[model samples]
Target: MVTGVEAPLAVTRVGVVGLGLIGGSVARTLVAAGVDVVATDPDGATRAQAWDAGVRTVGSAAEVLVERPDVLVLAPPLAALPAVLAELAAELPRLVADGGPLPVLTDVGSVKAPVRAAARVAGLEDRYVGAHPMAGTEESGFAASRDDLLPGCTWAVTVAPTTAAGDLLRVLALIAGPLRGVARVVEDATHDAAVALVSHVPHVLATELLNLTTAAPARALALGLAAGSFRDGTRVARTDPRRTQAMVAGNADAVVGALRDATRHLDALADALEGGDDAAVTAFFDAADPVRAALAEAAAGDASPRTETVALGEPGWRERLVSLGAAGAVVARTGRDAITLAVPPPSPK
Candidate 1:
């Protein structure tokens, strides 16, 4: 009987088990939407912040479950997800009957496959849907949380066959109602692969760039003069180092694959430069022009969603182009069979 203008579903209560940026934002949004929100965090400061913001605070995950919320969001670090899910599974049945069970569970981890595997190991896979909301600030913690952070952003929802449809819809409703966008359903593998290319690999690359610059005395003046272009380019590198390491390590294989592909692109570019063929350079620049244009269009919200069909033809060419686009790289069709995708040139590292 949850009745409110913003409440899309009958979720009377929601539990958020980590009052960090993502958790705090979700709790605040639900509370503002007229849903009861119970939040927990091991850090007393975070809990206090949530309480100060008008959310019901709890001592632990156990107490949150005692409320038997309609949904539970595990918003811990990516590496901590396995242990958290395991702990939740152990305490779940006691809080609610097996028939109704505890609340449907989901998480805001950056990676998915590992989290899904952890849920399976914890015996809570059926009730959980892996979600990656593509929104964040460089900031972290409860103080940095914002209710409007998720609006107009794309959230990837990964579901397995065993995931409850009702539970998934309820979660989606919460997101759409308060966050103001539809959750894009994607396979766990596809979601993980795409994120590895765009988010994960870039973090590593940015860190490498920063590290190389810091190590070189010759680059001191260059680093000082680094402007909007450098700042924007290396923005993700400014993320929490520990968190970045955890994300990159947790999804090692995919990140490594992306890095290798990126290396190949760099080698090719170097070879072209060494050869000093004006025609080759011109062709490369011409092909790259469109991708740069497309990226600008995408940033300006002008790029239409083109449903390009992938048919079997060349072995690696089409896939490479598509991967470029998926990685937030600029890709444009040069001709019928030929296409060009711009790669971000390697920095010092």
Candidate 2:
């Protein structure tokens, strides 16, 4: 069972695969916090860099299982999951032959259900948990990684019907405990759908925004006049296009729904402006005031946190955590029989 203590983190050692921005950051950040960390990347230079930063290096994904980390966090790109998952499975026998239990399996993947499916294929789903730190940059590779990325970020840690409460709490202990972060215990589908609305579709729209600027007849003038708003809106388009493509493709179904919703909203706003319906325009903007306020509060980092209890000793615990996450509550501590949940202030409607 996990305790409610904070700082110096509960997870003492973590093993990571793929030393790209997210994985590299995870290894770097945990090492900075005095963790005994081991990680691997295909790029030798990346492994050397992680070693320079005080992280132990492994030669390959299968070797990570040999190290027998308490938790194995695979941080590969969306397209690379299949290969790494296979690697982990191939090493499972070697790991267990030594009379050691498999490490808690998790990943930093943006999409969830597919990862779970892949884990099942590898026969590793029994120990698999899914987690996504709601933080990243328009950058790729270890060179662009930083230790500061995950601190205070809300991790969308996932739960499934078959998940053991203890397994869920182990991942929570790492994110919410020593790492000093908060997390939502969400269902995989729920996480995919919500992130599509907030992340994937926005990436698409931002890329489109950048594309529009390039095609404009006044391109040079507009480029010269581009200000903070334009930069802020389109910054993600600056990410490696292939990486962005993989991310959006990984969550295509939800992204399609969100994209159509965006289209419908744009169509309505255009109709209102064309008809000169000032009232309709006013109502349209008013309808999103709450979303605007919520985003503002989050950006400002001013929403104070308060606590509520989530019972973990009872049946339907997975469902309970899912409901709390949907309500925007985060697990602050997973105690012996309950989770101390930190609920942020309600967004104004």
Candidate 3:
């Protein structure tokens, strides 16, 4: 049985399909936790990397399922999830028909509604869980994988309506135990909406910012004048285009809504400045000051292993918590009216 998380069963072998940044890290972390990991990647370099790291390598995701690991983590790109789940759905019952145990399957995808829907359509709803790790650098591929990548990160887990409690707890055990991440359960649609605003839209905005400056006649001059602020804002523009496109496409409505809201805010700021409304301008910048402080305060709390819950309200709490560097502060669950944040406790001296 898993210890701290109190899972009903022990997970000794984990199968990881796809050895990109998230998958590679899962392989590395499971190995470090003394769990045998069987992984597959189409890329020879990534398969070799996993083999070198002591994880058993396989040729394809189908092979990983044939092995029937205790748990299988699907870590492929967002666009690839549907087909993969369908394949797994077909493969799983065959594996279990022979009286062999069926492994619990989970995916580390950014958007959830599409994946969950795919799983439902494939008749794999009970065995599948949707998860997103709110962690990663601006880098991709196996070379960027690190065991420490997930520590203190919020691993958002979304359980479909038909998911079994045992399956849910097992995923939680894996996330909280080996990964050293805080596991929080959220619904599928809520997960999609939350990520669209915070991650997907920001990535699109960064790409647009880069495009705006580069397409201008003064491009060379504009780039030369760019400073830390500009570089920081445009950092995610470096993300893999295919992956970003998949995210945008999967959550198109939410992305468009977020972008519209952002446009309105920008217009309000412009109107305030153009009209020479000193009070309005001051209020605009001043409103963001608390968010910055909230972030700093949250960051200071991450040195410890405790958690604090904050009821998400009125739009600025996420900015404050994220700014504080408390990666543990995440949307644990969302209700009709508000979200519940799992804030990490302050560190000890």
Candidate 4:
């Protein structure tokens, strides 16, 4: 319903290449918007869940390629991004490039620099934009997918100078409609560094904290007693190891730098505790309290909800995704109707 220049184009067909938490959420949101969604995943059961959720599923990227969707969202792990681009390049050169050729392509990869580099190398840079939706739960996988996950999160949209304005607008529309968050335009490097600071580095710190608890004699008891604060502090540490590791590994330098800064902050906190400086401790809390308050306020204000509609071209892909059993059926509706898709529950894994 949010009108834009591309409103005339009307996103009829959207192809999602993954059925993980992020990908499944995207499809569900699009379906709620009345857009026909075709999706594929390597996991068979995942595809079935997606179908139940109402999205059409396809067997492979090749099948999606043949469908020639209006937009292709590459929602894969950071490490798999390059290979996915390669696969797309080999499988659907002409179709993707049709209409003078080239469909608008975007990705939901957390890391940007490497993805951009890989796309550039693969010669898909022109149509591709690097995007990161800064919202996630401690859970993952298709079962965890939820349309509302994106609505109030920051979604970074990175583009090179060569990216077309129309294409950029279309990408923004897709992200903004579902996320209801700011479509921040940042350079790839800046996006990577920022995510490293706010996301990747925190996950590392949380993991370390959790590890300390694991070695304690009363670990089981401690875990049992763990309540809201402990859960909040260590939530990210509970995300899928493979996904978190890949993100950290991909953005190594920035994460390391952030960790160094965090260490310095921790050292100062330790000094205050050792010195028994009540004033310093109070000051620390004073400073942190306001920051946290402001962040919460900002997040609340920025994560407003909106409805998005997406149109579909064919039924094959939707049927295939439904069969994966990753999530549930997505139906067309207006005004926040698509926000209820199943979200993966948080697991120790």
Task: Pick the TM-score winner.
Answer: 2
TM-score, candidate 4, is: 0.74
- Model 2 per-residue lDDT tens digits across residues 7-76: 3325667899999988988888888888778899988998998888787998998888787787899998
Sliding window of 10 residues with minimal summed lDDT for model 1: 330-339
Q: After superposition, how far is residue 322 of candidate 2 from its true place, in Å?
A: 1.0
lDDT of 4 at 184: 55
Task: Give one digit per residue, the lDDT tens place, for model 3 in 26-105.
Answer: 89988998987889987888898889988899998888999888789999876677788777877776777789668888
Using all chains and alpha carbons, the TM-scores for the candidates as numbered come to 0.79, 0.91, 0.80, 0.74
- Higher-ranked by TM-score: 1 or 3: 3
Residue-pair clash count for candidate 3: 6
Q: What is the per-residue lDDT of model 4 for residues 155-207, given as tens digits with 9 covering 90 to 100? A: 67776666655666566656655435445556677778878877888889889
In order, the Cα lDDT scores of the candidates are 0.71, 0.83, 0.75, 0.70
Candidate 2 lDDT trough over 10 residues, lowest sum: 1-10
lDDT of 3 at 65: 91
Model 1 root-mean-square deviation: 9.6
What RMSD does each model have against the real structure?
A: 9.6, 2.9, 7.3, 11.1
lDDT of 3 at 179: 74
Query: How many residue pairs clash in each candidate at the backbone level?
Result: 0, 1, 6, 44
Candidate 2: what lDDT?
Answer: 0.83
Which residue segments of model 3 deviate by more than 4 Å? Answer: 1-9, 302-349
